[model samples]
Target chain A: MFDYKLLAALAAVIEQGGFERAAQALGLSQSAVSQRIKLLEARVGQPVLLRATPPAPTEIGRLLLNHVQQVRLLERDLQDQVPALDEGGLPERLRIALNADSLATWWARAVGDFCAERGLLLDLVVEDQDVGLKRMRAGDVAGCVCAGDKPVAGARCIPLGAMRYRALASPAFVARHFAAGVTAAALARAPAIVFGPDDQLQHRFFAMLGGEGGFIHHLCPSSEGFVRLTSGGFGWGLVPEQQVRGELERGELVELLPGRVIDVPLYWHHWRNGGELLASLTRHLEKYTGRWLVQV
Target chain B: MFDYKLLAALAAVIEQGGFERAAQALGLSQSAVSQRIKLLEARVGQPVLLRATPPAPTEIGRLLLNHVQQVRLLERDLQDQVPALDEGGLPERLRIALNADSLATWWARAVGDFCAERGLLLDLVVEDQDVGLKRMRAGDVAGCVCAGDKPVAGARCIPLGAMRYRALASPAFVARHFAAGVTAAALARAPAIVFGPDDQLQHRFFAMLGGEGGFIHHLCPSSEGFVRLTSGGFGWGLVPEQQVRGELERGELVELLPGRVIDVPLYWHHWRNGGELLASLTRHLEKYTGRWLVQV
Candidate 1:
């Protein structure tokens, strides 16, 4: 049997990014936290943590973390069923990894009422849409929203509709860069705004356009900043249709290639045994997300 | 003399997150990029990169990157003077690290016109306000906006006013959590929405209120998401005054402690010898940022 106290210490250390902060969060002395980690490693018969600046979990540590996450969900289920087991009425915390674009647009609206009503708390880790699932695989999150449809060994993946993006730029940017016309070659030559290196939406768009070589791009990791940079004539980029409705309507931004859209299909990946709470949240997302995303 | 091509390869690898992608960006074969890195490493007589999943630069690599960044700015100045020396008229790229609160609120508005007019493309990296200068110190950015006023070696720091934050919550949340009145004990027990692990804004606020020990927090990394989550009644958080003006006026959000504000002093850090273009940008920020941020 695994000791939950030690498991919690490991989670706290990883989340707080240091032993001192973990101790502070856990209301324990730094030495106590360090002792707990050492005990856990001794029990496992190998090192569970990488002794680095901000400590990282080793492969075995990840498996233990995954087990801890699953056990937490199961515990939530038990607490829900037996109200007497609830400790201090602390709101349940669920860590989920999600892409930035979704968080910026419809995610809060879709889940707000549900979370409030259920008295649930969220720890949201933002990653690129293409790689959000990695957080789940690394045991850093209970669930994730990503473009990948395949599920991890103990996880289930559900289609959550698609976010449609259009290559958009400001009127001034179009007048400056696309004066000759929006061609693949012009796109290759002109600078574009990318969310981050992990974001392959622009690369996928280029692939669809049959442009081979790498294009000049300016990295702007924030979705809001991406739009602002694009509309400010810094570059053209794929903006989610839902996010730029006002911009498009106000003529602050225009389609670079009219009617050419990139629809990124999204999937919700959660532990198969994530308990009643996770199941309920999944149902809520399934019911509400269609209002914001194109049905996949 | 050092090779600029090797430095470019190093920058590309760091920016693109992998050698294959860096090679693609440079229009070179993977082997050629590998050879250049090896050659550079041999010349330095030590390992420049820590071959992690995403390669990280060693201390010496950071110094080289710093040199590369400075040279790029100086080269831009030379190109500005002698247009014939310009390569393909590619718009100059400036990498910067900044806090999310500023990016979400006043940053784009302040710099939009300047970037557009100057044809300067930005690669904006988002970091916490307290630690943004670390990016400049690591040579990952040409400049940064942070709470720290002390400059790194060979860097110049200028005060850019302060961003005022107020403890805010949705009206219903206040009614539920603070019905008895806003007290330090109650505040510590109630869930708070934190920007991230590195965000000490809430902790600082708690300290000012004479509250000790760790508080319950839910991490939401995005500024836009933070506002939406706060307004959606997830938790109370210290929100920028500029960001929540609408929510306050509309009565959707209310101050947890009225008139209590946390003013984080902002500073702009740039390379000391970053040449004419960087100096102009520094001047532009100095002239305009006060219009948005609270005068320090």
Candidate 2:
């Protein structure tokens, strides 16, 4: 069997992008990190790292890194179970990765209930749905609610549900920007909230509007922040109905393009084992969000 | 996060049904196995094993055992990929669980070319479709070519073609049992080869004959052997057409009931990871079997 410790060390080094940084993060001597990588290469029977500027992982290394990340997550879960055996003090910690929008709106209450029921200490990592798997693969989180159907290696995935997005804007923002009744031409001049460089809501909105989402943008990283920004009259956004239900009902956030909506499918991804906690959490979330998200 | 090692040990004991047996199978001392069980129970904060007759797992134990099995299979996959780093060695070992009928017929040959080209080793575990998931849950196999859509908790499942079964009998067997113009009543009186005590083909055939399959008296365990027994004049059987192609062509085996065939869907289950070896194998199997099996 391969030495899991060495593989883990190598994975950390690759992920951190430098021997010095990895060594510092892991609290190991630089030589020790270097030696571990060397040993891992020998065990693998091939050079796993591309010894160049910034040092990148080779194809085989990438595969091994995925395995190492899984092992580490499993290890952390094992560690958490240790204290539970004693007095059940220090409630088990649950580290979950999730998309910004879901985390901001529907997930917080569910997460709170999860923490309360299990007495679990919570560690939430917020990221875009597209990149949540990377966080899962890097051992940064134990579970993720993501948008992709394909799972990271060594992680388990199930369809937790999907979210529905509609083009929305603060009534003030719309009244100020588009008096010609929310056409593609009117949307072109409107400022919109962009989640990040990788965010596709703007693009999707443009596609629905029969044009591209113009560069007049306000960038917000958090889903809740994005919603708040949009509601505060910063710009238009494809807001999940659950997040802006009250605002829309009260006419604070107006549906800019009625009858045009996008369904974004979401899935639950986590380490294949230690699924009970995650399964229970899934059940809780499903009960509340079942009607809001599209069923696939 | 669960202790994979302890969970694996617990599952081993459940499968083996005794500490000694489980220890022997795992190559660990009986004391070690006992300690592992104690540790696992301690970790979960509940008793896992019943410790009664046969030492079966409790409900919680079964739940964790299921998770452990998934983890072990994924771990085996990681181990299987180790040899791929070697120069021109076998890339991986695919431990596959498949129903007897599929194994005996087109699946083996369909995958033969791909396995040969990649020098991939296959560990085949033959079982009935109903019990294949149990084998998968027990960590006996990494993937399954079975009939079902209900996924194993942590595995990825996709439809991988289907097969049609037709009732067949040797000319001698039919001639000895029935006169010309054999009817459903004649089939009920004729001795038939049931795949096993739990085999449903005979029951399905009887259902088609407007009766139940309990009418079958003789039972054979092997799919290949079942066909052989039928062709040797023991009895009639519901056989895959692919298995008895030569027999049907040479007048050795005759279709007992013409124009009546049963279509059974098949699916492939594997770890969700994008393993190249698995991807290649699945591609080859699907490409060949898609031509014969039902699309849906």
Candidate 3:
């Protein structure tokens, strides 16, 4: 098998794009890095690096780099477990990414409770569910709770649960714009609320309505802010059942589409090597959300 | 955070249930495994494994194992990219889990061709899309192609595409059972071929018929067998469009429900570490299956 250390050194060299730069970054002699590469090529029976003005990875080199990264992540995970050998020190910090809606609703509170109980600190990054993986890819956070099934490279994923959405409007807004049943044409004329430019629920709604135009839309990025905007009669929006249940019961928000609700399956994605912190967080979230999210 | 090595050792120990067995499996001395466990406990500030009887992972230990496994996958990925420092063989063989249908259809051929070009070999395990994660959890495979949004803990996932299923039957079977327009009652008497005992396509069809019963099913474990059984006048089955398109054109099989087809979304799951071979394999699969599987 390939020597992991040597492969790592070669990766650093390729990433730095030159032996000199990679050697400096790795605190190794340039000649040593060169020799390492030579040895590697002999073993693989192919040239992994193309030495030129700027060093570049051959296709094989790219493959090796990918492998090296995975090994590194595994190593890091092993390192994390070393701390569990004792119980005296403070727990290590965790970093996570989540959608705004989940953050505003029960997710944050649940995470806070977990952190407090475990004596762990958490760094949270908020983003749209569609783009949460991007943050994870950039290493801005170690894990993410998002809607998509796809995980970024080098990250582990799990199913927390699904989030249900119901079409809702403030009683006043409904009274103004939806006096008649929501017809294909009438919906196009009504005002609607969207989470942001990237939000596609409204688009999906229109598609379900046979691609007819029906509504003008207002953009609200924050989950809390979106709720407020809808409650203040800005427009109709799909609200999470858990978040707007009280409003619906209190007659503040009316279910526009009572029988037909949308369900977005939510998943948890994290660096596969993220350790105990992510597991605890995932289990806790699943325990609570399992009761709420749609089964399947 | 948890130390990955400690967690891995703990998981292995728990799986093996003895220091000797665990050490043998891990290629380490019994003393090394013992030392690693001690270090792990110190780091986690809790007892991760109970030494009574066959060793078992504590809740905390299980949690740590989840993280460590994910990281290890990532590390493997990283290692794949680096060049070797000495003359040695390629890294360890890659293990993968794939949906039965994908394996039987074009995917197997595509993957085989790619691996041959790259001088890599893969160990493949066939599984249903729904249960592929369980295999990954048991460490049976390093990655999987499954049909769900949620991934197993410490595994990275991405959307592979979709598999479209059309209700199909042999011409002879259709002539005998479906001469009359198929209704819920008519379907109940018809014999159907299904992928396995856990196959639910027929149930889904029944549910769509206002909860009426439809079709008695014959379980076939192989995707290719399911198609052949249906085409050879055994029963009707929901077959992938790609798999049945040729047969349908040849009048060997006929569509039962032309407009109403089931669309199953598929996703790719693997250890998150950057493995070059895995990445290249994934890219090739994605490119080949693009539009062939789903619109995306």
Predicted model with the maximum lDDT: 1
Best model per TM-score: 1
Q: What DockQ values do the models have?
A: 0.50, 0.01, 0.01
- Which window of ten consecutive residues has the lowest lDDT sum in model 3 chain A? A85-94
Task: State which candidate, 1 or 3, has the greater DockQ.
Answer: 1
Residue B68 C-alpha lDDT in model 2: 57
> Per-residue lDDT tens digits of candidate 1, residues A143-195?
89888888987889989999999999899889988899888888897778888
Which structure is stronger by lDDT: 2 or 3? Answer: 2
Ranking of models by TM-score: 1, 2, 3
- Please identify model 3 stretches exceeding 4 Å from their true place: A1-296, B1-92, B109-113, B283-288
Write candidate 3's Cα lDDT for A242-261 as tens digits: 87676788898887767767
**Error of model 2, residue B287, in angstroms:** 3.4
Q: What lDDT tens digits, residue by residue, belong to model 3 across residues B1-296?
A: 55556766886675444687578657788999999999988887889888865576787777666555455545555554663532223223455667767754545445545643554434445667645787677655667887777867776777867888888887767887878977677676665665543467766875676544223444445554456556666667788888767688899888887778888888888765435666776678667766557764
Which is the winner by TM-score between candidate 2 and candidate 3?
A: 2
Cα lDDT for residue A140, candidate 1: 69
Report the lDDT tens digits of candidate 2 across residue range B103-143. Answer: 65555446645654554544455666667787666545667
Q: Candidate 1, A255: how far from true, in Å?
A: 3.0
Which stretches of candidate 2 lie above 4 Å from their native place? Answer: A1-296, B1-34, B45-96, B112-127, B133-142, B149-157, B196-216, B249-251, B257-260, B270-281, B291-296
